[model samples]
Target: MVNVAKAQDETTAAEANTGVAIFAGGCFWCVESDFDHVEGVRETVSGYIGGKSDNPTYKTHTANGDREAVRIVYDPSVVSYDALLRAFFRTVDPTDDGGQFCDRGHSYTTAVYALNEAQAALAEAAKADAAKVLDQPIATEVVSAPTFWPAEEYHQDFHAKNPIRYRYYRNGCGRDKQVEALWGDQARDGIGKK
Candidate 1:
């Protein structure tokens, strides 16, 4: 007889081995694309967070104060959260309180949604380190994570699905140029770099 209960336990154990990290770095499409390239990242889902709504759509979430974010599922055994934090800081303009790159508004601001106290501490430490490296104030907020609402299907992997449009938008926004000016080689280490 097949051990169904044992199989179920094994599946649960496999899932427990993974961890989630959420971050808002302007346009979830861009953020998702960036983290997807990371070594230990298992999956990246574009979404909205830090808002008060049951089901937030792209249209309504921004107006509702929900920030566009990415939910990263990663293998903790393969990569540490501190490494992810370093990558996150380098990938986005953390000094801009107004917004990131050309994207302006509360929804486009950068933030790290820490899932727990440990993650929050790591994020804070990372922020301090980044500020020291850049010699400027870091505006990225490390806030407690809330329920993450996955964006519409089309928003997911928009970069891969619509490479032309994605490239155009990314270039027009001057994301890479701005990041390079801010972080130099660290910016090139991120996604959306040519």
Candidate 2:
């Protein structure tokens, strides 16, 4: 007979080896959608971070200084954090300090919440490289990771749940076109094969 409990334990152990990276690149829905397509990305959760309030909701987080962010669970062995950083910078306009694309607000600003010293260093280096490549100062900030409050269940995988609305919003926002113009062929390349 199969040892179900042992199998479950093995699965848990395997998942324990994964790493987490959090980022705020404008709307959580769009950020979540973009990371979901990346290889080695196990999962992406839409959430709010860098806030003082406890249990922040979408309606209150922006006012509370929380930014719309995504928690990415990925296999480090398969995809390096550096690669993820490259993909992230390519997906959003790092030069925009006010916000991303059409979204203009504190909550929609781009950020990289580094979970550790190493990640922070990598983020800084990535920011510098991105600025050099674009020949413009990058506005994205690399800050320490904070308590991430997951957004409501309705916000999770929103792109998949509401394809039409997601398409409309994405196209209307001109996210892809802007990214393409910014990063050229490198745009969305982070979603490359595992």
Best prediction by lDDT: 2
Predicted model with the maximum TM-score: 2
With candidate 2 superimposed using the best TM-score fit, by how many Å does residue 176's alpha carbon deviate from the native? 0.6
Clashing pairs in 2: none
Error of 2 at 193 (Å): 9.4
- Cα lDDT of candidate 2 equals 0.85
The residue-by-residue lDDT of candidate 1 on 52-123, one tens digit each, is: 777899889977789999888889998888888888898899999989999999899999887766787898
Clash count per candidate: 0, 0
RMSD of 1: 7.5
> Which regions of candidate 2 are displaced past 4 Å?
1-14, 192-194
RMSD (Cα, Å) for all candidates, in order, is 7.5, 8.1
Cα lDDT tens digits for candidate 2, 1-194: 12222211212323687878888999999888888888888989999988888899989998899999998888998888899999999889999999999999889999988877777788899999999989999999888776788999999999999999999999999998998898988887776531
